[model samples]
Target: MDAMIPLAQFLWLAGALLAAGLATGILAGLFGIGGGAIIVPVLFEVFAAVGVAPELRMHLAVGTSLAIIIPTALRSYAAHRARSAVRADALRRWALPVVLGVVAGTALASVSPDRVLKFAFVAFAALMSGRLLFGRDHWTLGEQLPGRALMSAYGFGVGLSSPLIGISGGGIASVIMTLYRVPIHQAIATSAGLGVLIAIPGALGYVLGGWPHMAELPPLSLGYVSVPGAVLVGSVATLAAPLGARLAHAFTKRQLEVAFGLYLLIVGARFAWQLVA
Candidate 1:
């Protein structure tokens, strides 16, 4: 209880977290991109600035970001479901495998070094961005979505990769879905469902794995999850998400992808700079 006073005193950090939530919430709605791409970078900087040790800083950032995704993803999922955009069949086939990957990825995140994870995030995000910026709709490997085995394999990759960078697995999932001829709207809707799967296990894994080290984290934290940070961020994210959904219908798909791609490039560049500097 007493620990929270310090958080209130840190006006800049509070404000920054709130602002980051607002932006990411809008982005989550606008791009169906999970907003973790932005939140991970923002929280990393905040934790660094607050003097968290390098060892656990990235974990905290990622864990807290996952926590934030819970509400945001569920909200987006419900909204998309109402629109009948969700493809339940594809999700049914991929959910189990993606869950498996989520478990494995969470295990990896619990042990890997910050620099190694950041580098991986940078590389993966850059590739995702490149595909968005330049990849064409018709460039697909097959005429239709893959068989169950192959689809599960791709889901595994998304589940594994997303936790490493604190995302909800939506970005990669949507990209793959769209590439294989899933309509962009359906892809976005399906990814929202995927995000829910990613966030639940991802958040629990961080909390359970890091419980022993909870005391080392920043104020208002439970294990790796920052209570106040997640609450503030989640609140704003939930409020702004509907606005983004409405706005999503206003823009061309290409325009949204381009913006998302540029944003990810910036995220990658920030981490790369941090790595070298």
Candidate 2:
């Protein structure tokens, strides 16, 4: 029955994608995570079902996921801002370096080998898990390490790495803010704001870098961004994200942290296995 369906059956696929996206979107908003943790795996399966090449599958998954995150992140930021969780002062302070870092990272990704990218993502996920598990009880020094210079360095590292893995830089942002003893609410809000910074250059890089190879892609694709898929997923995610923000208010901060940590562990394990295979 599955084999009989046409690959481009847009409506059915869109419905399924919308439902899945909504669920993940809510999780993203509530947990202050980039939806990439869920989106990448699902997108990989979706692209495979549509016959995307094995070699290009990860690239497409990452690109499309990042593309959708742009708007989703913006919507999440707005929602958080409404609650006064977004610290505009901090965002302003970090913006320049984060944007610059994203541009540099995106440019670098264009020239880097795919294997290196994959390995880097796996390593990142592992490191994140280790930090969360073992360092949960550790308090941040909170002494402020050279202010803007330190932030720029962290921002650059996050910008350079997130797009390559199809994320919105939220995970890294959360960790950095946590280590600096930023309040959880403020950390989440700041991370959402950073998503916009990350997505812009990352999306541009994917489009430009992958353009020459366009002829090899599936129909209706703009470089690596799958327009139809992005539309379907982004729409639902926007609507669902606000609900997640509401849910966040219902849970204790510590509980939310544990839940989010476990979620990352599962997703990280899945991606690691995929990379290994």
Candidate 3:
């Protein structure tokens, strides 16, 4: 179960969720953020305003964000596949480990304290965003993509940390692949695919693990997910995602990176403010 809110709060949260979904989906397609970098902080604020307990706010936010990501990720994945931008071989190689990692992440989140998860989300977001925005213009750990074993480890880490912060593992994946000399577009597209991987299992994990907390949840919630929230947000996000993929095609990598960096800077500033607040 997730947070509980009055009808008025519910209405406000739903509206915000839809907007967040729209923006998050587009950002996901364009920058491999899986929408959580945006959604997580926004959800925290929304839930806080709605009177969710301080200690439970981050958990509910992460769980609910994962729920909404399902359709958004799928739409982005389809769009990328249509463009043939995804690196299928890498996805295939990384799939198993990634799934295992999702389970691990969810299990840990189930037991994790709220503040820990919140700051983890903040720190992780800052790290990945900073990496994308400020890392060397042309950096490579290897001349080519890493070997299967190494890639598997990378995927595992992405999956493990992604759900912890309410993401699709895409941000980390894109950074790793791009740094390893993968084309930025291909890295982004494959990260969309990876987003799907993270969303599906990650959502289910949240649902199952969180089911017992019904007393704390809003009406119609399934585990930490507000079903209404998912439907409202997912609808717009699903629609917007393909459009984002299309838009992404129009931008040069440098331009995209600059835009993404600016976006992260804004997000980081918000987190910094929250830390002090």
For model 1, how does the per-residue alpha-carbon lDDT over 1-277 read when each residue is reduced to its tens digit? Answer: 7877576645656777788778767887898555678788777877777677888878888899999889878988999999999999999998999999999999998887888779878988899899989987678877578899899999899899888888898878887887788888999899999999999999999888778887677666878787767887778877887888889998998999898889889989988998999
Note the clash tally of each candidate. 0, 0, 1
Which ten-residue region of model 3 has the weakest summed lDDT?
1-10
Candidates 1 and 3 compared by TM-score, better number: 1
Clashing pairs in 1: none
Candidate 2 global TM-score: 0.81
Compared with the true structure, all predictions reach lDDT values of: 0.84, 0.75, 0.78
Off by over 4 Å in 3: 1-9, 15-34, 237-277
Model 2 over residues 1-277: C-alpha lDDT tens digits? 6754546455555666677678767886788564676677677777777667777767777788889888878888999999999877768877887788778776776676666556666677677766666665466857443377777788778877888787888877877887777787888888999999888778878888778778766656777777777787777777787889899998987777777767767766766777678
Error of 2 at 7 (Å): 7.2
TM-score of each: 0.87, 0.81, 0.82
In model 3, which residue pairs have backbone atoms overlapping below 3 Å?
1-223
Better-scoring candidate (TM-score), 1 or 2: 1
Our model 2 lands, by Cα RMSD against the true structure, at 3.8
Candidate 2 error regions (>4 Å): 1-16, 26-34, 82-84, 238-259
Candidate 1, run of 10 with poorest lDDT: 4-13
Where's the lowest-lDDT run of ten residues in candidate 2?
3-12
